[model samples]
Target: MKMKGLFLAGLLWMAATGMQARGMEHFIDELASQQEVTRVSLGTAAMALGSMFTDTYGVKHIDVLCLEHCSDEVRTKFGQAIADLHDPDFEPLVSHSENGERTKIFVKIKDEMIREMVICHVDDEVAVVRLKGKIKPSDIEQVIQDHGSDR
Candidate 1:
């Protein structure tokens, strides 16, 4: 009985770990299923094309969700969802507001590499983007610099 209990506990731990690993992706998918949201998922091939112009070489997958002209209830729900993501695992890397629009960037890091990045933008239109891969902070900094120079 002791051995069986230990085995079951191990299985449960593994299951929980796996779920946490994909938590961001699952959240994005859930939002995508809503009638007011539009989702776009980009795979490796698309990311490869994107890397040509930006510093996306380390990004393996990207999920984008856009909610436009949504009801106030929907907006409140989305805002709460984003707020719930501000846990120890996901650190807020950047947050700013401009022209009535607010944007927040969060990153989850493991072993000194960023494993996932989530960008949430709230305004007249809500947009959320998730990027998953092993990325260095410098890679993100370079992307920001490159884009900033273009403006």
Candidate 2:
């Protein structure tokens, strides 16, 4: 009888943990299921190749959802969803708007390293990109400096 109680507690704990982990991912997946959106996912190997020319050195996974030619309703929904997003693990890093386009970036950090990043961009089209990796703040600063020098 004691073993049965322990098993049920274990299962409940796992379920709660999984739900927390899937908080943001669940919304992204639902959005990607829309007929008008295009979803692209890259695993570790693909990310290594795809980011060869960029500053994604430590990135292990990437998921991108692009919604082009979508209706205004869909665009508004996407924006609202991002605005309403609240996750304990992810903290807002940067948010800005330029030329009628808005961009919001959120990051999840663990052990002094960024474990996940979510970038939500809304313009004429909507784009949501999620990057998972073990990245240092200095690494991101270097990328910014490198790009800033181009101007």
Candidate 3:
């Protein structure tokens, strides 16, 4: 009888865990759908995607898709700094929007990088899919200029 109870508990736990995982996935999708993702770093494990939103505190705001935890201040500063270079919002970061079923923009930050993903552009359904490509802190504009439309 004890064994039966333990087995049932384990099954219930597993089911609960699975449900939680699915819920998180849904949340991710929902969160990604509503944002102006600027730069995304696919390589670095740090915060790779930065969502730009200037809160009342003048703090930079970013939502990275990497595997790391960043304080609100750090996110704010980075977002603000990045924004300053381009209309203080990085809207032009959506450069070279080649019409594809999907599209991505690579954002470079200082130490680590993050990716900003956009999904289903063809269908007018933009979603923060994931890190689009490698990111770092460098002259992204210069690199693009020098590299000639590769990055």
The candidate that wins on lDDT is 2
Find the 10 residues in a row with the least total lDDT in model 2: 48-57
Summarize candidate 2's per-residue lDDT along 33-110 as a digit string, tens digits: 888888899999987887777757588998989888677899889888887777778899999989988889999999
In model 2, state the lDDT of residue 139: 87
The Cα RMSD of model 1 versus the native structure comes to 4.2
Cα lDDT of model 1 overall? 0.82
Give Cα-based local distance difference scores for all models: 0.82, 0.87, 0.38
* Better candidate by TM-score, 1 or 2: 2
Model 1: residues with Cα > 4 Å off, grouped in runs: 1-26, 48-55
Evaluate residue 109 in candidate 1 and report its C-alpha lDDT on the 0 to 100 scale.
98
- Ordered from best to worst TM-score, the candidate numbers read 2, 1, 3
lDDT of 1 at 50: 86
Off by over 4 Å in 2: 1-22, 49-55, 149-151
On the 0 to 100 scale, the lDDT of residue 68 in model 2 is 83
